[model samples]
Target chain A: MSPTTTEDSTSSNHGYAKTSLNTVNRYRGRGQYEYQHVYPIIDEAPILHVAFHGSPDQDDFAFPVILPMLGCTGNFEEDPNNDGRRSIYLHGYVSSRIMRLSRKNPASNNIAGAEGIPVCVSATLMDGIVLALTPNHHSCNYRSAVAFGYAQVVEDEPERLYAMELITNNLVPERWQHTRYPNKTELKSTGILRIDIHSASAKVRAGTTGEAREDLKDETMRTKVWAGVVPSRMVYGTPLPAPTNMFPGMPEYIEDWVEEWNEKAERYSAEAAGL
Target chain B: MSPTTTEDSTSSNHGYAKTSLNTVNRYRGRGQYEYQHVYPIIDEAPILHVAFHGSPDQDDFAFPVILPMLGCTGNFEEDPNNDGRRSIYLHGYVSSRIMRLSRKNPASNNIAGAEGIPVCVSATLMDGIVLALTPNHHSCNYRSAVAFGYAQVVEDEPERLYAMELITNNLVPERWQHTRYPNKTELKSTGILRIDIHSASAKVRAGTTGEAREDLKDETMRTKVWAGVVPSRMVYGTPLPAPTNMFPGMPEYIEDWVEEWNEKAERYSAEAAGL
Candidate 1:
């Protein structure tokens, strides 16, 4: 698993340089430029929001397209071209538009031979709903991260399999091994987009509601309103086996993982709310 | 609540025109263009992923910036210029970059009176984890929607209040009335961007795993692997009171809402898995 230490840093303040591109303008205290703070948000998020221009040509469409995609961050040990930083591996179909675009256009970044298309992948984790004295003061406690990079399809067989395993196991631990192995056609058809990061940032808003001084002073309003946070988390219910399944119910691996996930998610949400 | 009729339609086949801009080319069967199918996905998602170029000049950055924002869909009845279609109202701070951008730039759409900066708002609801026979076929059951629109700040006080109430209550039922009303200062400082949608579409993927025929034929592999969907949903836990809170326990309304939300969310997720 990717390291997720917020308070302790193994590396000494290593992060993206605060340029105009990666800086968080509003609520500056909540903004984090560190690798530990940002990468964890991307790895933990259930879904990633990816945005890219519809076509390789800039003039083709004025609006950028946003699609919900499944992906996770990983470092491929064998890839000599990899810059050592974790790259995002996105699970998609071979025929998807994003995959086709990435294959068509190589990135024209300052790097000597970067191969990819421009893209931004973002993820948000909602911890709790903050309710204050007034509607304006109400906010949701969240951890959000955005990474801008160049996305290219993984052509190497070993690298593609690595990404496939990384993504599958990321969703459910040991899921890659639990399932049947991919055949030749299946392996060929699966598309994995590896996003080489250029710059990124993470923003987090935690703790109880921050109310206005005027509202807090009003005794009547303070007493009348039910002010606090409602903790929220993604809960995994009982796994429903497919009709063709020979087994009667969820296997021990699946059930145990689901239980542990629900427990941790619940604990984190409540912890964020209290903070 | 916004209408959520998937199989039924209030109007006779009312939907956005099928344009190359909003088509789901990859999965044709899952694509939906109807108003009922699209708008609900935007409303139900916990947070919306909003994307727009960092600058109005466009050439400054090759990648579009993505931010997570809270919002809901509503139609303004009082506005004479209202096109009768639902518009997304985003809750943001007055000094936020998006709020400032919306105020500075007016949409250059064909409509003479249209005012706002161009934006794309997308939302995704993750229902379940679909575990297929092979890792290659592994997928998630999801409902996703994307809406392209022009977002302008709501200058009108009444319209602004409408949006505030809509957003507050959408996050929590009857939350607007329960809390202290927004004062003039609070109202003035708050930013609400109403997005007048131009084109939108929804895509949904549900049901049991659809595996390869070749994989299903292998009895040994089928029996060894456990394949199913792990249903998932956002669960609201008990109200976590802030240190400043006077109340000893959660109010009846908060308790009831949390209970109902958990039940509905759980039910829907499991149902989607079965479908």
Candidate 2:
């Protein structure tokens, strides 16, 4: 029955969640989402896979899992089906913090609607590989998600302004009021799109690798190499505010997210360390 | 005429290549590719692209571009009509080295075919991100390629013996003869898939950022943040051989790639220091 001495694997299930575009099932596994053993699943998940309203923190809706700081929306292509999928196509512009510095067209402050470019985005940071001692136990640990949805361009000035507020809030959680809002011409040049949630699934392989009985008996294979999880984590230090900005203070919302990120990071690091 | 100030100017050319994929006039731009700035154009100037390939002396592919170790063969999707496109259908797999150490799979050897599970293959690394000061200028300087095609199980006793030699020679070159080939059963269980190199694209963005005229004039904008490229590169120190194995001489192939990789690391270090 062991993978080494035997050919037929009775192990059937590759534990992973299956879902559509609306409701995401909660996954319960030995490891957390940020486990270092996680592998990046591209075909199964995409950033815009689900289009949902602005409540990014709520569960079951596919939007919250993704970090919204990066540019998520692009030009909207009306769905041919009248079923109201609420979708937008993105160009491959990796709209990250660096994009803001480029300022290619100040007119089109947002990469979308500017030059009619679509966006395809992907972001991942891998930490370590988890080897399950058993062939069936072979698995990777990682924290990842793919979101896809259509964003409708907020063309009306008032709507665009309102959308910008939501975006700024999304990133910093209350910095909109602190910074000056865009003017009329600026509003016209800017692009804003609303995304709707569709469906999402999460896959994970955690805990110790499963070992075959035969291989364990073979002493030659016992001490071959350094076998242990290399712990990895994305740690965030306190923000260093800009010199020019006179801020009321760090908003609780922003603080809350950072705290969550840190707590999750600690958990992942501990798991990776096998502590 | 600047984007910041230009309100109603019209330029019909969106910088897209004229002619269709179906026509012969543009075949040059389609079949053979060349780089015009960051945008890859086909055949407009084939000479410039291949110019880098000839020089074996350069340490890094920075000045002269280097072709990927393995070129992809087909369209990203499993398109039926894309003949001679040279594509690869790759599934991810954990290497034998990691498998044995993690205590997973008691199999004596962790190579593909040994376990009968699908072999996941990859040979790629991300080199760097080339950040130009301008947003449009920002691009990642990365090295990546996917190997496609499935492995043919090494069946012939003699051929299987030689196949392990081939893998070592392919990876470390010249070292195959120095090491012993895998045994009959070792070969039987090992999976060997022939990968096809079909359609592929190599992209890079280098040089300074595009400074907008308006930003240059606006001291407020200029003084705002720390701008410019963040140079990143993967530098491998001398390889630490597995503690179990003892090597008396180095193979020419392994010797050659290491030297090449080091040269690249040196050049990147120099560039970073200059910045």
Candidate 3:
């Protein structure tokens, strides 16, 4: 049921402009099909992966099922980074198997194009390792995206409670006004889908990690190699509770959202590995 | 070419003991196919999506291409967690397209079974978020892993210099004896696949995040929602260098591998979220 504000607005308003299925043929200058660069790398990826085309009439044992779902981009009306509307959603388990193959092929049965189940979502993050001085110019400082969607199966119930409160405030922020809302057997064993993207790309690779010029004019391989960038982030630590928690501590919005996502994941992974 | 000491030592020595393609049909007790719980969650995952099945004569527009490669899991003879005879390898870029579709399908051309190019290989980590008490028992103290392989295309050169010194000591440990080794035109534009794995699992889902016993005897919905866990990990900061790094700092093996993987990812994510 497409129209959940599928944001296309006559493309190219600061890129996301590629077609031929979300182009980015080999680092094409760090591709970036925009909706503000692929919805903030699919809303700061904590997990997306997805892929698809599983068992589709098993042609040569056709099996391409990459899972790790749980998603979020937005649009129950606004801010999914408000620009090019939005879509993405995801969440799972209505008897999974990609929501029973996105409810048996839907995307309005390919209105002359990309039908439902042809997924391929993805999302990385990394943010540092680089260390290149050779070892074939090693890399990692990342960001990654890749969206090409179609999905469907989000049968409205106030847009599935506004995509479950935008995926539970994208995991934290006001956690859907403190849980307990999805009853009716947890919205009938949950399952959300929605995608509708159809052209998304975002490859980042942040700073520090470039070497060749004959290994930076080989001063004995630049003083016996040791380029840089360790960076890498993702924090949050110290919270725990739960074993029948008769709460009395840890909750000031989960300790200010674990110190605000550990200081924005250590200040954007050391300002994107420039450190 | 599959024999750079291919591992498989007469199977079943402690986990990775599932077939029917690495079975774990939904939380079968947090399925783990063992080799010490799946090669330390495939060597502490910091990227390894990889899925596959791309062209397959384009059935239903078959496109399953999850990327984020750069892998680990070893067996250059021993310690790939020293058991199930490891495999995984990965690395990319020799005219990439998944190393030319794993060198045109070569799992010894399916000698009566699991053929090449099948691939799957996932990997996650997360370690904490839980916050249950409903929201369908919100979870995510993760660990993931998937595996099931076939891949091929490595074409030995001392097993591609032992998988480029085990993926440059997996990005930092002994930083592969300080770079510059890959020479022959950087080993002819490097490639490396080698999956071969065949049956691997590992689901995990560490402590705290169980709700449903009438939302823990509903003490006003557990003191107005705020179950627990948060935790998460992955740190490794401070390093930065490279603008033509005429190296003069940051390298005592990259600051002891960023303080030993940031104190083993903050003490195994606060002891797997039991904090």
Worst 10 residues of 2 chain A by lDDT: A60-69
Which interface RMSD values do the candidates have, in the order shown? 2.6, 16.7, 12.6
- Model 2 misplaced stretches (Cα beyond 4 Å): A1-123, A130-139, A148-195, A205-210, A230-275, B1-89, B92-198, B231-275
Q: How many clashes (backbone N, Cα, C below 3 Å) per candidate?
A: 2, 67, 7
Tens-digit lDDT track of model 3 for B1-275: 22234444325666555644456676789887767788778777878898775554432244567788888877655543444467889888888777887777765333235556777788888877887876767878888888766887777788878988887787577777877776898887888877777566778888877777776667976876778787888788788786677767766767876888888888888888783
**Model 1 ranges off by over 4 Å:** A1-13, A56-60, A78-84, A108-114, B1-13, B56-60, B78-84, B108-114, B247-249
What does the lDDT come to for candidate 2?
A: 0.30
Here, model 3's chain A TM-score works out at: 0.38
Q: Which ranking of candidates, highest lDDT first?
A: 1, 3, 2
lDDT of each: 0.81, 0.30, 0.73
For every candidate, C-alpha RMSD to the true structure in Å: 5.1, 18.1, 22.5
Q: Least lDDT summed over 10 consecutive residues: which range in candidate 1 chain B?
A: B1-10
Error of 3 at B60 (Å): 30
Calculate candidate 1's fnat: 0.71
